[model samples]
Target chain A: MIRKWSIALLGWGAILGLLAPMLHTIWVSFSPDSFLTPPTNVWSVKWYLAYFGDRRWIHATSQSLLIAGMAALLAVAASAPAAWSLGKLTVARQRLLSILLLLPALIPPAALGFGLLPLVYFTGLWGTSLGLVLVHATVGLPIAFLIIRTCLPAKLGELEAAAAGLGANRWEVLRRVTLPLLTPVLLAAGIAVFVLSLNESLVSIFLATPTNETLPAVIWPQLRYSPSPMVAVASCVTALLGMIGMLIVIGILGYQRGRLIAKNTTAINS
Target chain B: MQRISSWLPVFASVALVCGVVMAPLLLLLRVSLYEPATGRGFYTPGTFTFANYAIFADSHVLGIAGFTVLCGVAVATMVLAIAYPLGLFLCSLPPRAQSIAVGLILVPKTAGLLAMLFGLQRWLPRGMLATIIAEVYLVLPYSVIVIYIQLLNLDPTLRDAARGLGASPWQVFRRVTLPLSLPGIRLAFQFGLMWGLGAFLGPLFLGGPSETTLAVELHRQAFEYGRWPLAATEAVGLLIVVSIAAWGVPTVAQLRKVAHS
Candidate 1:
C-alpha cells in the first residue's frame, strides 16, 4: 500500500514541480504591483496593457510573428514535395534523408546557430527578417516533415492508384487526389512549425540584432540587464501564443487522431 | 526516362535540405581556420590560422565543456528516474484522467521554454539549480510521454504472470516492467541528454556567471566581442562533444527501421 501510494505521491510531486513555475509566472503576471512580485491582494492586467501600449514591444512582437509565419509557410511549401519525393526513394536513401532532415535538431543548437551566423553575416543578411526566416525554416523542416509524412495516410497511395487507373496524368492525380488529402495535414504542419519557430530562442539570440529583435530577442537582454514586470507580461504573451498553438493543433488533428499520429512524431521540443 | 523524371524532384528536395544543414558545419570548419578577428571586421577575411582551436587548451574553456557534460549526465539521469514512477502513475489513471494528466504535462512543455525559465527564476533563486530544474521542466513532459507509451505497449500478461507466480509488486516491476520499458527509458535519457548537452537558454538566463556553457560563451564571443572565429571554434567544439555523447542514440537507429517500414 505504501509503495503504490508513494509512486502516486512522487508522480504528482513531479507534476507540481513541472507546473509550479508556469503557475507562479501566471500569478505574478496578474500582479498590480509595479515591480516583479506576485500580487498580495488585487490582480490587474495593467502590465499587459502597458506591454501592448509600448511601440518597441509591438514592433518586436510583430517581428516574431512575421518570422514565425514566414518560416512555417516555407516549411509547409518545401515539405509536401520533399515528403512525396521521400516516398519514391530507396528505403536506405529515405532513411538517410530522414536523418539529414532531423540533423539540425540533433546538433548542439549553439553550434547550429553559430554556423548560421557567419552565413547570415557574410551574405549581408544579418538582422534581416529573411535571414532569420530561412534559418528557422531550416530548423523547422524536420518537424514539418515528420508530421506530414506520418499524417500522409496510406489511403493516399490507393487514391492515387485509382486516379491513375481512371487516366488521370501525374500532375492531374497530384492536383486532384494527393493535394486534397494533404490540405488538412499541411495546415496542421504549418501551425506546428509556426509554434516551433515562434518559441525558438537560442538561434534567435545569436541572429537577432537591435534592428530585428524578435520577442525572445527582446526578452533576452532584459533578462540579463534590465529585468521588469512588463517583461513578465511579454513572457506571458509568448506563453499565451504557445497555449493557443497547442489548442489549435489539437483542434486540427482532433484529440484521438492527434494522439494516434503523435505516437510516431514525439514531442518537438524545439 | 519516366523513372528518372520521377526521381529528379525528390533528389532535388533532399539535396536542398542536406545542403542547408551540412553547409553550416562545413562553413564553421572553414571559418574556424581563419585568423582571429582584428579591428577591421569579424576576421581578416583572407588569412589562414589555427590559433582559435588553441582555446580548448585553456582550463576555463575546458571547464565549460566538462560542466556541459556533467549537466547533461545529471539531467538525463534525473529525468529517467522520474519517468518510471510517472509512467506507472499515468497508467493507473482512467482514460479521461490520463489525457488530462498528459495535457498538464504538454501545456507546460509547449508553453515557451523562455517564459517558463523566466517564471522559474522568480519562483526559485536564479542560478544553476534553477537552470537544471527548468531543464527538468523542459524535458520531463516528453520523458513521461515516452515512458508512458512504452509502458502502454507492454504485454500486461507478462507482468500479470510474474505477479501470479507470487512475485512481489517490486519484484514484478524489477524483473518484468523495468526490463520491458528499457527502450523507453533509454529514449527518455537520450532526449534528456541531447538537450542537456546543448543546454542553452537554461544556463543563459537562469544560471549564474559560473554556469556558462559553450553555447552561452559562443554567443558572448561572436556577438559581444565580434569574435566570429572564436565562436566558430567553440561551435566546432560543441559539435565534437555532442557527436561523442550522441553515440548512445539508439533512437536514431530505431528511426532508421521505422522510416523504411
Candidate 2:
C-alpha cells in the first residue's frame, strides 16, 4: 500500500514537473503586464497580438514551417526505401545497417551542426532554407527509418514472393500492394519527422541567417537578452504546432488500431 | 532482373548514407587535424598536426570535459531514479489514463527546447540544480516510455506466481520485475546519458559560469572564436564519449545473452 501511494505521488510529481514550464509559458503569454510585475489575474492576448504584428516573427514562423515541411518530406523520401530494404535483410545485417543509419542522430547535435558548416559554406547554402532542409532531413532520417522499419511486417517477404508468383511485376507489387499497406506508417513517420524538425533549435541556431531565422532561433536571443512575455507567446505558438503534429500522429494510430480490430472481427466471422 | 532491382535500393541507400552522413563526419575529422593558419584562415590546407587536440590538455578545457561527463552521469542516474517509479505507476493506470500521461510527457519533448528552457528559467533557481532538473525533465518522458513498454510486455504469470508463493510486493519487484526490466532501464539510461552529454540549452540558461560544459565551449570556439580546428577536436572528443555510451549498452546486452546461452 505504501509503495503504491509513493508511486502515485511520484507519477503526479513527474507530470507536474513536466507541465510547470508549459503552464508558466501559458500564464506569461496571457499576462503581458507580468513582465514587470508578478503574475496576477489580469490576462490579455496582447503578446499574441505583438507576436503577429512583428514582421520578423511572422517571417520566422513561416520559415520554420517551410523548413520543417520540406525536411519531413525529404526524410521520408530518404528513409522509406532504406527501411524497406533493411527490413528484408537478415537480423544481423539489419542490426548493423540500422546502427549505421542511426549513427548521425547519435552524434551530438553540436558536432553535427559544426561539421556541416564547412559543407554549407562551400555549397553557398549558408543561411538558406535549402541548407537547413538538408541538415534537418538528415537528422530526422533515423526516426523515420526506425518507424518504417518496425512497421514493415515481417511476413512482407512472403507476401511479396506470393505476389511475384502470381505474375505481378516488381513495380506492380510495390504500387498495388506494398505502398497501400505502408500509407499509415508513412503518415506516422512524416508527422514524427515534422515535429522533430519543427522543434529543432540547436542546428537551426548554428545554420540560421537573418533571412532564414526559425521561430526558435528568433526566440532564443530574446530569452537571453530581453526576457519578455513575447518570448512566452512565441513559445506557446511553437508548442501549439507540436501538439497539432502529435494529434495527427494519435489520429493515425487510432485509425490503424480500428482497422486492425475490424479486420480481426471479419476474420472471425468469415 | 528482379534481383538487380532489389539490390538497386540497397546500393542507392548505402551511397546516400555515405555521401550525406559519413562524408561530413570525415570532413570534421580531417579539419580537426589541420593546423590553424595565421590571421582569419581557420586552418592551413596542406599542414596537419595534433595541436588542436593538444589545446584540450589545458586545465580549463579538461575541466569543462570533466564537468560535462559528471553532469551526464548525474543526470542519467537521477532520471532513472525518478522515471522508474513513474513508469511503474503509469503501467498500473488504465489505457486512457496512460495515454493522457504519455501526451503530457510528449509536450516537452516535441516542444522547442529553448521554449521549455525559457519556461524553466522563470521558475527554477539558476545553477547546477536547475540544469540537472531541466535535463532530467527533458529525458524523463523517454525513460518512462521505455520502461512502461517493457512493463507492459512483461509476462504477468511471473508476478502472479511470485505473489502466490507469498512473496511480498517488494520481493516481487526486486527479484522478478526489476531483473526483467533491466534491458529497458539500461536503454533509458543510455538515452538520458546521451541527452545530458549533448545538452546545450539547459547548461546555457540554467547553469552559472562554472557550469559551462564542453558543448558550450565547442560552440564558442566554432562560432565566437572561428577556431574550427579546436572546435572540431572538441566535437570529436564528445562524439567518442557519446558513441561509447550509446553502443556500450547493446554490446553488454549481447554479451549477457551469450553468457546465458
Candidate 3:
C-alpha cells in the first residue's frame, strides 16, 4: 500500500511536471510584460496579439508549414517504397540494406546537420524551400522507414502470395490489399514527419536564409538575445501542436491495433 | 509493360533522393579540413589538414567533453533510479492505474524540449544544477517507457512460482523481476546517455558558461566564431564520445546476458 501510494504520487507528479511548463507558457503568453516575469496584475492577451499581429511571425509560420508539409509528403513517399521492399521483398542484401537505411538515424543528428550545412551552402540551396524540404526529409526518412517497418505485417508475404494465387496481379495486390493495410502506418508516419519537421530548429537555424526562416528559427535568436514573453508564446504554440500531432499518431496506432485484434478474434471464431 | 514503366519513375526518384542524402555526409568529412581562406565554400575540394583535429587537444575543450560525459552518466543513473521504482509500481498496479501512469510519463515527451527549456530558463535555479535537473527531467520519461515495456513483457509465471515456493514478494522481485529488467535498464541508460550527451537546447537555456557542453561548444564554434574547421573538430569529437557510449551500452548488456545465461 505504501509503494502503491508513492507510485500514484509519482504518476501525479509527472502529470503536474508535464503541465507546469505549458501552464507557465500560457501565463507568459498573456502577460502584459515584455519579459517572462510572473504576472503581477490582470493577465492580458497583449503578447498573443503582438505575436499574431507581427508580420515576421506570420511569414515564419507559413514558411514553416510549407516546408514541413512538403517534407512530410516527400519523406513518406521516398520511405514507403524502401520500407515496402525491405518488409516484403526477399533480397540478397536485405540486412545490409536495412542497416544502411537506418544509418542516418543512428548517426548523431548534430553531425548530420553539420555535414548537410556545407552541401546546402555550396549547392546554392541554403535559403530555398526545396533545400529545406530535402534536408527535413533526409532527417525524417529513417523515422518514417522505421515506423513503416514496425507497423507493416510480417504476414504480408503470405497475404501477397494468397492474393497472387487468386489471380491478382502485383499492382492489383498492392492497390487492393497492401495500401489499405498500410493506411494507419502512413498516417502515423505522416504525423511524425510533420511534427519533426515543424520542431526542427537545429537544421533550419543552420540553413536559414532571411527569406526562409522557420518558426523555431525566428524564436531561437529571440530565445538567446531577447527572451521576451513572445518567445514563451511561440514555444507554447509549438509544444501544443507537437502534443496534438503525437496524440493523432498514437490514436491511429491504437485504433489499428484494436482492429487487428478484432480481426484475429473473428478469425479464431470462424 | 505500362505498370513496370510507371513503377520505374517512382524507383528512380527514390534513388535520386538516396544520392542527395549521401552527398552531404561525404562533403562534411571532406570539408572539415578546408581552411576557408579560399573563396570557395564547403563543397570545394581542398587538401586535408590535421589542424582541425589539433585544436581539439585544447584542455578547455577536453574539459567540456569530460563534463558532458559526467552529466550524461549522472542523468543516466538518476533516470534508472527513478524509472525502476516507477516501473515496479506500474507492473504492480491495476490496468487503469498502469494506463494513467504511462500516459502521465509520456505527456512530457510529446511536449518536446523547447517548452521545458523555456520554463526552466525562467523558473529553475540557474547553473549546473538546473542543467542536471532538466536533463534528468528530459530523460526520465524515456527511461520509464523503456523499462515499463520490459516489465510489462516480463513472464508472470516465474513470479507466481517463486511465491508458491514460499519466497516473499520482495525476494521474488529481487531474484526474478530485477534480473529480467536488466536489459531494459541498459537500454534506458543508453538512450538517456545519448540524449544527455547531445543536450544542446536544454543546456543552451539553463546552463551557465561553467556548464558549457560539447554540443554547446560546437554550436559556439560554428555560429559564434565562424570557424568551420574548429566546429567540425568539436562535432567530430562529440560524435566520438557519443559513439563510444552508444557502442559500450549494448556490449555491456550482451555480456551481462551471456553471464546470466
Q: How much lDDT does candidate 2 score?
A: 0.80
True contacts kept of each: 0.63, 0.50, 0.32
Off by over 4 Å in 3: A87-99, A153-155, A260-270, B1-22, B36-45, B90-104, B250-254, B257-261
Q: Write the per-residue lDDT of candidate 3 for residues B33-92, one digit (tens) a residue.
A: 766445544222456676777766788888898888988888888888888877877787
Query: lDDT of all predictions, in order shown?
Result: 0.80, 0.80, 0.74
Give the Cα error of residue A57 in candidate 2, in Å. Answer: 0.9
The worst-scoring run of ten residues by lDDT in candidate 2 chain B lies at B8-17
The predictions' CA RMSDs to the true structure, in order, are 5.8, 3.0, 4.0
Model 2 residue B55 CA deviation in Å: 1.5
Show the colliding residue pairs in model 2.
none
Better of 2 and 3 by DockQ: 2
lDDT of 1 by residue, B1-261 (tens): 998776665564465456556887899999999997668788888889898899999999999988888888888888888877888899988876776677677776665666677777877776779778767777778788889988998999998899999999889989999877878887788878887888887787778888888888888898789888888999899888778777756664576588799
How do the residues B1-261 of candidate 2 rate in per-residue lDDT, one tens digit apiece? 987766665564455556656876788899999887677687778978887888678999899999889988999999899888888888888887888788778778776455677788888878889888887877777778878888889999999999999999999999999989988888788988887898787787788888878777888888888888888899888888887778775644686889899
Q: Tens digit of lDDT per residue, candidate 2, span A1-270? A: 997688787787879878888777777778747462336776788888888999999999999999999989888887888888876677887887788777766677777778888878887888789988887887888888877886665455766676788899989889856776678888888988898888888787678889898988888878866788888888889888988898888777657654743453344336
Q: Name the weakest run of 10 consecutive residues (lDDT summed) in model 1 chain B.
A: B9-18
Candidate No. with top TM-score: 2
State candidate 3's TM-score.
0.87
**Model 2 chain B, TM?**
0.89
C-alpha TM-score for every candidate? 0.88, 0.92, 0.87
